[model samples]
Target: MNKLSRLLLTASSIAPVCLTLIFIGWMKDSRSLMIYSAITAFISWGLCWSLMQFAEYKLERSHKIIDSLSPANKEVTNYFLSYLFPLLGTDSIAEKKEYAIFFYLSLLFYICFSENYNFNPLLSLHGYKFYEAEDDTGVGFVLISKEVITDIRNKTFKVVKLTDYTYLHTTDRE
Candidate 1:
């Protein structure tokens, strides 16, 4: 399904779970239960927001690098976050403020109903050591100062550049 549908599904799926907790609290007039529910919601939504922020930060950092190199190659400016999270396409990237607002709203909804649901942490969802081939044409991939790409035989990730091979979407190399 699309991002909107997936988002809706996530919100809908979590709602009943959280509402049930709220309902239990109401039935028993238990402040503790209510507080617990609230905490759970906050944590769940907070983490989600943090993850988005982290992704944004990564994109922005990449953007700066792209911009710095824009003088020589103007096309790099077109390399957007959509390229990273294809679920959100070029259109969404254009209206970043709107997307951010909607994402916040969605997180609020998800949090309200996220209390009782069990979800894996972000780390659990994807392991590190993700590799994408350097495929930015001649430029290949630019290495981040602290980033290290392991050399596994002939195939290895180049830390500095986002190669098409390592671009994640193109090759599924990660």
Candidate 2:
């Protein structure tokens, strides 16, 4: 779906829950609770849009990289990208890529906004690592600092760092 559709979907999905929470707060006459709920809902909406933008940016960059590769490498990359998202079960490369982005963004939304908006840094790191590990084409690059990626890999994967920037190895490489 496009940006506007995604935004509308997210708002529709979140509206009921947000309304319920705010209603409960209103009934209890807890101004603080109602205010917090409204703020949280707004932040969640903004984050979803931001994540979609980031995904689009990454998709464009990956397309450029894929275009620059040799035909043989491009085929290999396309194959991996095509099968990255099992839940979607889609044969279309474009749909698979969109599913992967949605999956990561959903995970990020859960980690950042759910459960009273308590940000779990470790969960976020692990989620990114898991997403990266699943993509054989190395196209699912989660935008994070190099140092953060290095730390997460060292702590979770225990793999030797290959470089300062590009360290995570895809399964198809070895």
On residues 63-145, what C-alpha lDDT tens digit does candidate 2 reach at each position? 11211111112223332332233324323312233443354356435423321111212223333221132123454222222
Over the stretch 11-78, how does candidate 1's per-residue lDDT look in tens digits?
Answer: 43233233344444555565555565556555554554454334324432222111111111222223
TM-score for all models, in order of appearance:
0.28, 0.29
What lDDT score is found at residue 47 in candidate 1?
51
TM-score of 2: 0.29
* Each model's backbone clash number: 13, 0
lDDT (0 to 1) per candidate = 0.33, 0.34
lDDT of 2: 0.34
